[model samples]
Target: MKKLLLGSMLVLGATSFGAVVEDLQNNGAKPAVLNIRVKGTVVDPTKYSLIVKPLDATNTTDTMQFNFDGLTIGEEQIVEGGYSAGVYQNNILITDDYKIETSLKRNGQNATTSEYDQMAAAKLAYSLGEPQAVGREYRGKVNVKATGKAKGSFVDNGVNLEVLVKNI
Candidate 1:
């Protein structure tokens, strides 16, 4: 009975050590900061407004497959005009400023001016983390919703959209 107990202890110890080793070997390096960028356009700004949100947004059931780093991440499908949304992951880090910048252009002109108040309302609806080191790396998500209405006819590329993730 004593010999059996000792053998059991040795087997358990070996199994635990093996697991630790396997984890260490399989643990690839994660990015210290992930820069996510979403770029798309709204076809007819006058007829429809652009709505951008996370795939896992509350009460959100529509989702499209998005490929990120070879992994399939859920994407929120844009139901408006010819607008398609996607998330792009960048391993680079933004050290200077930490903020969401939105740019809208119609016919190669800035659409965020007071002349385009409705378009200027475009903003970051949800942001996960701040630009600060709280003793650990920051990991979260951001959602940008650019809403606007242009006074013009339907052009194939009526509005241009650009959303950049500086820090988090």
Candidate 2:
């Protein structure tokens, strides 16, 4: 069982820290930060499942996926896919930050968990880089509801999950 638990931790850890944010402080640009808060019901509160998609003004075909398959539910989750610097800087981030659509599932069947809040969500703190007048924008937004034609992607059996996005 130790191996199984260890493996789970490794996977979760990788999702939280994939690549370091780029350093653009010399260019007079400030690093961008995103604060994601989630609430409502889910399949397994103890399990974490998420997806991050980069957004750009003109381009809409870039996305990155991560698996946080251990953290519990109803808490604030902090995900830093990479880093950003300027707007239309040619090499700026695809989008200002990212949009997350989430759900819960298990054994290919819908599951349920107790209420989750912003405090329980994992925290993804943004590192400083450079300062800029404008940054990327939040694109492709999704709001999980109790009943309104479940939107976004689903996990093992997650069908009633909720999600919220914030740019800080």
Candidate 3:
């Protein structure tokens, strides 16, 4: 009877170990949606155009980027900047690090006066894995030396960038 109990215990232990291994392998192998959104509002959209662009491939790791440099007040237009999510895990899309670079410019001056770069979104996505469903926001503080017609004027102190990751 003692031998029988020992054999049963060993089998049970092996079964539990297999389950743990399976869980580890399937952790990030699920279908998910990684929706990338870049949102900002113009507090004083009087004479300035907020030119925000997703950094070029060199500055980004994920397969997504956008250009919202011509964003107007209350405007939420979608502009694509050559992005593709080719990496997939268990039918879920995988993303790499991403950064958004924004500039504030005087409409008529054709010059950039202020710049902001935010990368919090990319870091968050990578940490959450493939099946993560959450949203994140990053604030970048910027100091701009007044130039062109806006000389001596203070541009906005900072910009808020947001990214959303969800499961499909």
Candidate 4:
């Protein structure tokens, strides 16, 4: 009787341990939510046009890119330096010489901007453009593009620009 009781206790303990391990594994599989803010100034509004769209628009089967699934862009807000009558419409910000900013949120928080360069470098990429086989629809990353009036026109990415506007 004593040996039988010991064996039962061991089985119960192992089952409890397995349950804890499973819980941890499931929790780790959950996705994270991320919020990305992009802000920049247009040095020459007349010379450049900006477009914002989903990252999947740039995807190709030939090239691997970051999985930007679950990203959505908010409205672009003109911070300063624009004409008094400037406006944003059709996912395009129409304004003259302005500082602009936009926000992108992902998954509830699955991806982040910091992970962009790393994932791109690692080649562990996926596209959220099409619906997944699992019947999940994801809102993916925002693609912000700036094009100049002339062909091959140059525009700065604004990684090192100073504070041009404030108070708004």
Q: Rank the candidates by TM-score, best first.
A: 1, 2, 4, 3
Per-residue lDDT tens digits of candidate 4, residues 34-117? 434466644544443333222332333222122222122321211111111123344344443444333223344433231222
Q: Rank the candidates by lDDT, best first.
A: 2, 1, 3, 4
List CA RMSD, all candidates: 20.7, 20.0, 22.7, 20.3
In the predicted model 1, the residue pairs found to clash are none
In angstroms, give how far residue 60 of model 1 lies from its true place. Answer: 15
Q: Give the count of colliding residue pairs in each prediction.
A: 0, 23, 3, 7
Model 1, CA-based lDDT: 0.33
Query: Which candidate gets the maximum TM-score versus the true structure?
Result: 1
TM-score of every prediction relative to native? 0.21, 0.20, 0.17, 0.17
- Scored by lDDT, the top model is 2
lDDT of 2 by residue, 1-168 (tens): 999899767666654554223335877587655444455433443433232333433222233333333344443343323212222223333444544333333344433332222232332222212222243532332222221122222222222223333342
Per-residue lDDT of model 1, residues 70-155, tens digit only: 11122222222122232222422324434444555567765543122233222112112222232222222333333323222111
Model 4 TM: 0.17
Better of 1 and 2 by TM-score: 1
